[model samples]
Target: MATIDLTEATFPETVGAEGTVLVDFWASWCGPCRAFAPTFSAVSENHPDITFAKVDTEAEQGLAGAAGIQSIPTLMVFRDGILVFSQPGALPAATLEDLVSQVQALDMDDIRRQIAESEADAEVDAGS
Candidate 1:
């Protein structure tokens, strides 16, 4: 499996899709981001069940800003369109693999349900 190129156009469909998604937020000019690219690609190949996507901060500033990404090489894991984990930094390959496994082991159904409840609460607040 190869890493999926995530653009602002495809972000909603990709990240918000019903599945396990790993999004790598990066910029081409950042040294750490460049260094982590290959590792991210390799991880994508290694984990066929996980959807790995890359967001170019330079080109997709809106998406990056909305994600509140203040640094390069930020990895965010989402399960069923709900954020499960987020960290800023370049992780070693082994650590990155461990993160994927850890996320996979979590109760994704519960997370998704929680997210739905929060969203509903927000909607009610907005309407009030």
Candidate 2:
């Protein structure tokens, strides 16, 4: 599948949907972002089941800011409406592929349990 351009309006629904969604936050002016575009697009073609989307930082400043995008080439991976991985920088094709493998292997139920435990711990600490 070709990478889709995500806007502030479409961002929520797209990422919150079921399955894996890979979002690349980028800007045309950044050299690293330009370098990563081809790799991102190529990987998207290979993973037809995954939704690969791009957010142009310059065009969608509000969305980018809301997403905490401090860098031009930030990659955020979401699975089953939960953010599984997020990082900044241009990733090589091989590394990106490996990341996809890792995300696919994750046990989301365990992840959710951990999140709930952490939230509960935070709440307990706040009550102290």
Candidate 3:
């Protein structure tokens, strides 16, 4: 699927859906962001099942700020409505493909269990 432009309005619904969603936070002025755009788009074409979305940080400052985006070309991967990966930098195509494989291979049930355990631990610590 082609990369879709994500605004503050569409971001939540698009990334919170059932499947995998890869969001590229970028600005047109950044050199790395420009270099990564083609690679991001090319990878999206190969992964039709995943939603590839881009948020222009310059235009969507509020959304980017809310996401804690401190750098251009931040890539975030969401699977099953949970954020599985987030990093700042432009990744090579091969690395991006490898990341896709890793995310696809994740057992979400185990992940959810781990999250629950962590939250419970946090609650216990808070009470202590």
> What tens digits encode model 1's per-residue C-alpha lDDT throughout 26-45?
98899999999999888888
By TM-score, who's the top model here?
3
Which pairs of residues collide in candidate 3? none
How do all the candidates rank in terms of TM-score, highest first? 3, 2, 1
Candidate 1 wrongly placed segments (more than 4 Å): 113-128
TM-score of each: 0.86, 0.97, 0.98
- Model 3 steric clash total: 0
Pairs with steric clashes in candidate 2:
none
Q: What is the C-alpha lDDT profile of model 2 across 55-108, one tens digit per residue?
A: 999999999999999987999999999999999999999999999999989999
Candidate 2 Cα outliers beyond 4 Å, as residue runs: none
lDDT of 2 at 30: 98
- lDDT (Cα atoms) of all candidates against the true structure: 0.89, 0.96, 0.97
Predict model 1's lDDT versus the native. Answer: 0.89
**How well does candidate 3 score on lDDT at residue 111?**
97
- Candidate with the larger TM-score of 1 and 2: 2
Model 3: what TM-score? 0.98
